[model samples]
Each structure stands twice: as structure tokens, then as C-alpha cells.
Target: MFNKKHYKFNLNSTFAKLLGSYLIIISLILTTSSLVFFRKYEKLIVTQEYNLSEKLLNQANYYVDFNIQWATSFLYSLYLDEDIYDLMFSQSSHYKKNGISKLKHLNLSSSNIDSIFIYNKFDDKFYSSLGSPAENYYLPSMKNIIYKSKNTFTDAFIPSQIKINLKNNNITKNIISIAILTSKSSEKSLSSAVILNLNANTFSNYFKHNITNNSNLFVMDNNGT
Candidate 1:
């Protein structure tokens, strides 16, 4: 006769208990490891994103500061240019032509410079590298430029001088202006200023080129513009 053996599983046996405990410990270890790994990965991703954003911001700030410094230095040089002084104080058209030509050349050579305006208080005349003089209607803003003791940066604004306009009359290109007040003599008040307009797209394009499409960026001064 063939013997048939049947075994029943005993839940309370020492061997069963030991096997259950081993399985429970292994499950716990796996769950804990998974949690720790996940947490570490999440933290690492956050840190990397923070570093990238910080680097981008620093690069943008440096670019803007460098341009401003360059503009400031250019203005300082203009203050020493005899042509500019003659254009402001003298009645000679020759000096005026030379100054205008110089401005035109400079404006043409620079990619970022949008427009250049030289306001002479003596003749109440404005000369521009863009050809036509700034309309006298904007005289208040011009005077404000000459009155400032320090170099001033303006909020993004539609230039009254640049006639280049979009199809919609109201839609005009925004420009940021850097103006410097200058005086030929120490005894005299500032009688002239050079207003240099920079295309707002320059900064925007810079950010676009350096940053990913998914990112959003803003450039603002203390006044929040």
C-alpha cells in the first residue's frame, strides 16, 4: 500500500513565527530604504534648481551692471569731448555738425544703443543721432535729465523721438534711457545732457538666450520697473 502524508500548517509554531518575523523585518527595511532614498532625491532636486536660478540671476545682474558702467564711462568721455562742448555752448554749425556726426557714428556702431539725444540749453535746441531733434513738447523730461547730479536710469518708456512704431499706433517699443548731466565750466550749472536709449529687448533677449523656455524672469530696479 502506498503511504499518503498530509501536513497541516501550524501558525503558532516557533518555525512559523521565526519565518513571519524575518519577512516583517525585511519589508520594514525595504520601506525605510525607499523613503530615505526618495527624500534624498527630492532634496537634491530642490538644491539643484535653487543653484540654477541663483546663477541665472547673478549673470543677469552682472550684464546689466556692466552695461550701465560702460554707459557711465562713455558719458564721462563725452564730457571731455571738445566737439560735444562746442555743440552745446558755441553757435558754430561746424562744431554742431561734427558733434552730430560723432554721435551718429557711435550710434551706428553700437548694437544695444537705440537712440542718442544731445540737449543744449543754450540754444534750446536738441540734436539727435536719429536725425530729427526731440520734440520740444518733451522738454520737461529733458530738463530733468540735465538737472540730475548723478547719472540716471529711467523706467522703460516709449521714446517720443523714435518714430519707429508698431502697426498699432498705441503699441510702441519700450526703451530704457541712461542720461548724464554735464557742464563745461565748474561755475556754470549743467547746461547739457546726453540721453542714451537702450532697447528693452536687449535684456529680455539676453535672458531668453541664457534661460530655458519654461522659466520666467523679470528685471526691475528699486522702484520696481
Candidate 2:
């Protein structure tokens, strides 16, 4: 015969076991909910950062383009100046001296302009903001060394010594040099170069001001090279 009495349920002990199981289930549910909330918060932060980075990059591009356009306009004005042409064509030493000084003064006044160089194809001479015969002159043989790409802005090139003042304890300064080749409708060719010594600290400060969280901001060129 089956032992029905021994198998009978104990009400208090059974209730205690049921209650323990319910508590464990509740703990697991709470843990899962917390984990889900944390993950959602993390994803939101990442998305915000990405959006901010994109906005900054777009602003930087605009700034760079504006700078380039400003430089090109200045160069065109210089090229069209009758005085500049008279100096170059006449081969007059006096005119060259005065013209160089004028160019230097003009260059110094422009914001972000480190130096400016004008290469006279007529005399094969170079004039720069540094005053006399440009120390960093590019010879005729070195012309067109860089590739011409209308779609890309070339990488930044730093000249070892753009200006050296022997009188000032032989101080040498590095400059960020950029060049553009120009051709007139009349088949006349002229090369104009601009050097800008970027103030890194000032630039970084400007970026910080424009960007809310600059930690995620990064800059890269078109080539991704």
C-alpha cells in the first residue's frame, strides 16, 4: 500500500520555499532591467559625440575654404597691379626694392599671413615678405615639383627656414608654405605662394570655443592618406 500520510505537504515549509523562489525571480528581473538602462545611456552618449564631431568637421572645412579664397583674391589683385608689373618688366633695381617693401607691409597686415612670395619669371628672381632676395627662393628647375590636383588640397608643407635674421642671434623660423600655379588667359604663367604660420594654441582655442565637447573632434583630408 502507498504511504499517503508521509507524502502529505507541510503548509508552512512549502510556503517558505515558494516565497524564496519568488524573491530570486524578482532579483533576476531587476538586474536585467538595470543592465538594459545602462546600455541605452551609453549608446545615447556615443551618438551625441558622433553628431558633434560631424558638425565641427563641416565648420573647419568652411573656414579653410574661406581662407584659400581670400588668398587667391589677394594674389589676383597683386598680379593686376600696374606698379608690380612695371617693377618686374623694367628690371629696375630701385623699383624692385620699393615693391618688395610694399608687398611685405601688405602681407603683414593680412590675418593668418606668415609670408608672401612673388616669383618674377622675367628676371627669374623671387620677392618675399622677408625683404631682399628671398632666402627660401625656389629656383626655376624646382618649378612644378608638386602635382596639380584641382580636387585635393595638398598636405601642409613646413619650410625649414623661411626667414633667418643673422643680426637677431641667427634666429630661424619655420613656416607653413602653400603654393598655387596661375595661368592667364593670354598664356602667361605665374606662380604665387603663400605661407601661413598657424598659431596652434590660438587655433585650438578657437576650436574649443566653437565645439561644446572637443574631445571627439578630429580633422582629416580628402585622400584619407
Candidate 3:
């Protein structure tokens, strides 16, 4: 007598329960492995991104500092120029005019120079390549700055420390400035300052190009402004 009910399958059977438990344990193991792999992959991606950002920042910093060094060296060279010194201290207007013409020629030597101005505290006059009365407005503002170095760069102008808007040129742009006192003596109150203004586009463009859409980079001075 063969009875089929004796061999009938049942969900509540011990064997069925054991199979279900095995599947659940296998699922948990697989899930845990996948989670661990995902975390490791995430960490690797983060480390790679951090390394890239740091490298780019270092490169940008190098280029920026190099440009500033070039500017300061250029300014110092111009400061020592006999013609420039004569222009700053000469009593004759004709000699000063000649110096101004020489300044125009010097201004053309570099494309980075926005403008060069020489302020003689003795005569209370502004001599610049721009040859515009607007220099008077700008030169006075720089006079108040407590200079920390003989040939040091001014702070990067996020908003432009000295704004220039000339009617003839009609061009508005940001600039970084470096000024040198022309007097040889200790009494600097009556001395002249030769100021060289550099276009800030070189630095701004590098930062803009290196930064990603998700990241931001800032170049700050000692003041951290």
C-alpha cells in the first residue's frame, strides 16, 4: 500500500525551515560583503580627489608667487633706473617730461603692466603713463598704506583696492600694485614713490581654470581678507 500523503511537502517541515535559514544566512553574507566593498570604493575615491586638489593648489600657488616675484624684481629694476630717479627728483620740468616719455617706453616693455605712476611728495604731483588727472585721485589713497616691505606686492584685489576708470580708455580692471620709495636718505616724508600696477588676470584666470564645479579656491594675503 503506497500512501502519497506520507511524502507530501510542507512549508512548516523541519527541512523547509532549515533551507530557509540557509538562504537568509547566505543573503546576509553577500549583503555584508557588498557593503564593505562599497565603503572601500568610496574611501578610495575621496582620497584620490583630495590628492588632486592639493596638487592643483600647490601648482597654482607656485605660479602666483612666481609672477609676484617677477613683478617685484621688475619694479626694483625700474626704481634704480637713473632716468626714473631723475624724473622723480629733477628740478627742471623739461627733464621730468623726458622721464615721463621714458616711462611710456618702459611701460611697453611688459604686457602685464596696467600702468606706472610716480608720485613726488616734494612737488605734490602725479606722473603716470596714463597722463590723466585721475591719477591724483588714486595716488592719494596709496599714500596712507603702511608699507611693510621695500618692494613687496599689494594684496590681491578681489574687488580691486584701487579702482581706475578713465574717460579716454574707458576700461575697468583689477590690479596689484608695488611701490618703491625713491629717496636715498632716511627721511622718507619728502621722498618719491614709483608705483607699478600689474594686471591681476594672470592669477584670477589660473584659479578659475584649475577649480572644479564642486570646489572653490581662494588666494589670500597676510590679512586673510
* TM-score for each of the candidates: 0.78, 0.65, 0.77
What's the lDDT for candidate 2?
0.55
- Model 3 stretches with alpha carbons more than 4 Å out: 1-8, 12-14, 133-137, 146-171, 183-190, 221-225
Could you arrange the candidates by lDDT from highest to lowest? 3, 1, 2
Off by over 4 Å in 1: 1-3, 133-171, 183-190, 220-225
Better candidate by lDDT, 1 or 2: 1
Which residue pairs in candidate 1 collide? Answer: none
Candidate 2 TM-score versus the reference: 0.65
TM-score head-to-head 2 vs 3, winner? 3
Error of 2 at 61 (Å): 1.7
Worst 10 residues of 2 by lDDT: 145-154
Error of 2 at 165 (Å): 5.7
lDDT of each: 0.69, 0.55, 0.71
**With candidate 2 superimposed using the best TM-score fit, by how many Å does residue 152's alpha carbon deviate from the native?**
16
lDDT over C-alpha atoms for residue 178 of model 2: 52
lDDT tens readout by residue for model 2, 1-225 = 886665756657978789888999999999999999999999999999889877878788887567656655665566566655554455678777667777668777755665565556567566666654344443331233222323122344333343345555554444444544333212244433322333234344556788765266554457552
